[model samples]
Target: MGRSIYCVVTAAGSGTRLGHNEPKALVNLAGKPILHHALCGLEPLGDLAGVAITAPANYLETFTQIAREAALSYPWTVLPGGSSRQKSVYEGLKGLLSFEPGNGQLPANDPTAIVLIHDAARALTPIAQFERVCQAVESGCPAVVPATELIDTVREVKGDTFTRQGLKITPAGSTPDRSRLRCVQTPQGFAGDIIFAAHDRAREESICEGEAVDDAVLVATLGHEQYFVPGSMRALKITYPLDLKLATWLAENPDRD
Candidate 1:
């Protein structure tokens, strides 16, 4: 049996990049919405205790209605998210822990075992990959994160600001190796109690971690070791307008058994 799993899907972004008034997750990805594909993929993971979805504050109810029509087959609640993506993640996590008293600061007796944090934009999350996150947590790591190996040559540019079109950077020597790097993805699972504590410490210590990729980065600073699960390209996130075409392509050619 799988642990008591709570999948938190973050869908708070306005579809500015996707070029729509609808939330990115609500945008059509075939016959269904991007969020529908995500929830479809997530349904196989144990008894989906609950799903905490974050959406734009104004459209929270709109997304909630969309979720209902998707027939997601799980208990879900829509949470109004924050200004930034990381802040949105924190808000979703808080909603998951709403089941706990005092807002996620309780002890082991009332533990929520494993929590899976995913993105609604990444509609292509595969069952096999999600299984990998659960399997990794079974070994007792305080946190478990999924990362696909990087295969590109990345560079670091120095100076106060970047002259490049969109890439941003910090001071010297802050860039990580492309070879050694793993492009992180979500539903990164964690020991619920520990991850909650980790986020708590992060809030206390004023650590920004710069929206590293997923929640696991913030958890890492809270003195927890993250175990990596091999990831797949099928789980790519649909963040840009071009990604919509890719999602349509994926939908047309699913490898579903």
Candidate 2:
């Protein structure tokens, strides 16, 4: 039998940066809501078991309605998001754990189940990116993330300081080897039990908000090695107005990438 795949979509961002009155997921991209585009990206996954979406507490119904409009063939559940992204993901995982597996039986705690954690802001993510991450996870990677190589020079800041002219400046503490670095993106795939244990450990240890960078980081704390697949520019996260403009253009030119 094929492994059961579950998706957890995090859509709790307020989108104040986008200048939208609604949550980030509800912001429109092209002719559809960002959340709608995100959900549609999963359409090509044939073995998907279900999707659990975490939305703003007040906009749970709106998110559910949008998910329904997406009309995916798999079962879905919409739940209230938590205060922080880490907490929100934990909530979504818990919701998935309680999902009914459709045989009038409780879902099994299948350690082999594949779980995908995605972001609604990355509404333009392509189906190929999803497939790549899943393939990596299925090939015995406990955790997998899609990442793009960095193109710009990177510097580490020491702190605020002053030059000889007394002009305030922040000195470069060190220069990281840009060749070894990569910018990470989502739809991060993981074995279900590894992800669940990572979240549970974080909650029990009261991991600080700043410490939990992403699901991969949480899993790393448990000593699990992570793997990465090539990512696409089409997966650009829509955060600022300029990003939305660029995404609109990309959506219009779907064949370009």
Using TM-score as the measure, the top candidate is 2
lDDT of each: 0.76, 0.86
Taking all chains together, each candidate's TM-score versus the true structure is 0.85, 0.93
lDDT per residue for candidate 2 within 37-108, as digits (tens), equals 888888888677778899988998899899888888878899998988899998888888767776432242
Error of 1 at 133 (Å): 0.2
Off by over 4 Å in 1: 99-112, 160-177, 209-213
Candidate 2: lDDT of 36?
92
lDDT of 1: 0.76
Q: Cα RMSDs of all predictions?
A: 4.5, 2.9
